[model samples]
Target: MKTLLSAIILLSSVSAFANCPEFKVPKKFMARESLFSSRATDMTFDAGGNRIAKIEERLLSATTTFDLYDNKRQKIATARQRMFSGGTEIEIKDCAGKIIGKIKERVFHNMFDIYSKYSILDATGKVIAESEKKEILAPSFSVTGTNGKQLMKMRLSTFSTRSLDEWVVEILNDTQADPRILLMIPAFKTSADNRETEK
Candidate 1:
């Protein structure tokens, strides 16, 4: 029974949006996830069904890192995480080894509001975007650009189950940000959410 249940969970991860006709079929994941592990690893795709990028998250000792690669499997960028008692910070560097962007969790959120906020900054220290959990019941985040407009979102697929969390990252508006930077938002949010859950 345990093996059967595991099989079911594994299979369901691929069809996280199976019941949501509005989103059509979900992007199939190429990673093998354990029953309760929260590590973020998967291949993302665009609406045209073309492979967008691949993300692999790893946690070792005090550091957690996520590597993003292009469809050709070439390293595009690396996000190295630094965890703090108050919040978390992730530094993103391109393949050329230059810092490009940063993802930082806000230390304080509104006491009355149920939101965990994060800021996305460019290398020059300009706030480029913001991310926050918008859904209370489940994991769903809204990424808004500096203009205070929604640029993208990351949410669990409609058919996602408790055993496995299948995520769907969608871009809602046009933007000039690097696709790799935008793509890592889901994994970054996952890491932050997982850390909060542990605490």
Candidate 2:
């Protein structure tokens, strides 16, 4: 009985240590902008399907927030972005409001049209991930780890005209990635698109 109990405890500990949840990247996901209000956008697995996350933007406010939820509508993580004169900064926090990561735009790339880069930092401000967007005719973005290994790739499917558009996400190194950060990709891409339109 003692040996069996010890084995069970060991298995539990291993499971806890390997807590990265597996999320299958759908072929295409949809994001819908609010027509009546400029307050929020809903992102789902498919058109009129289960809502996986929401991005809320306040009118005349510098901060934009995103909430990610599981299939059961349980909140997983929340991210907030504050725009400054120089660049935008993002904070990614867990449900308990503990910041897990930070994303800051590379200010030097602001003047260039070829590509834009952002560094993803951990709680201790160490760069754990880096994202870059290629400004081609068909734009695409890729996220890579500190070791320069690609973690995720996202290709724009359809441009947002009036309401809905599609983006296809491919998860490469999921084990090392925070799911909340994956959720924030679409929001970042949307912001980039808006910036291009203004220019």
Candidate 3:
């Protein structure tokens, strides 16, 4: 049943983005495990292996700051998370430094890190989408729209190795969601899980 559902999502994603050539529909993206050293995450194309977007973390800062860039290395969006906060809060902005969206972590079943929830908000602080971590052995997340409709499903690719990990972003619905938001889902999972271990 899971495999069938995944196949349906793949077909829907390809069909929905087929007409839109301008936006690149990302199949998978790599996020490095940056714990001690400062490293950046890059989302690349599978065909030519060209980088489509990059996420960089700031050095020696109290709060976590991330800069998102495009293929041309142009700044597209930025995410900032404050330190010493109970709940995780990340603010996303456009290249012009305008607020675009925010990701707020929500409380869920705290038993064995099996469940988690996050709310994605637009500039006006309206909930545009919501993400929930699936309770499975392999890492997976389900993104739903404001109307409680599933929009996308992100799964950590099985081809991931020790050096790098890839996340497959599959669009499930016809709704157009910002790719940057989709990219941030796995990143949040990594960071949030790390936080839980520290406690």
lDDT of 3: 0.65
Tell me the tens digit of each residue's lDDT in model 2 across 92-163. Answer: 887657677888875444454566677878777888888887866766778999887888777767664534
Highest lDDT scorer: 1
Write candidate 3's Cα lDDT for 1-199 as tens digits.
9999999999997676443223355444444444534233333433236566666666334676776766677667778875435467888876656676888876566657657688888788888888887756877788899888988887777876544556676677755456665666676566555545556
The estimated TM-scores of all candidates read 0.69, 0.69, 0.71
Report clashes for each candidate as comma-separated counts. 0, 0, 0
Measured over all alpha carbons after superposition, the RMSD of each candidate to the real structure, in angstroms, is 13.8, 8.0, 14.2
- For candidate 2, the C-alpha RMSD (Å) to the true structure equals 8.0
Against the reference, the lDDT scores of all candidates come to 0.66, 0.65, 0.65
Better of 2 and 3 by TM-score: 3
Question: Model 2 misses residue 55 by how many Å?
Answer: 4.1
Write down the worst ten-residue block by lDDT for model 1.
17-26
| Model 2 CA deviation exceeding 4 Å by range | 1-36, 46-60, 107-114, 158-164, 195-199
C-alpha displacement of 160 in model 1, angstroms? 1.6
For model 1, residues 96-176, the per-residue Cα lDDT tens digits are 567878888865556554566788888887888888876557767788888888987777877566544557666677754
Question: Model 2: what TM-score?
Answer: 0.69
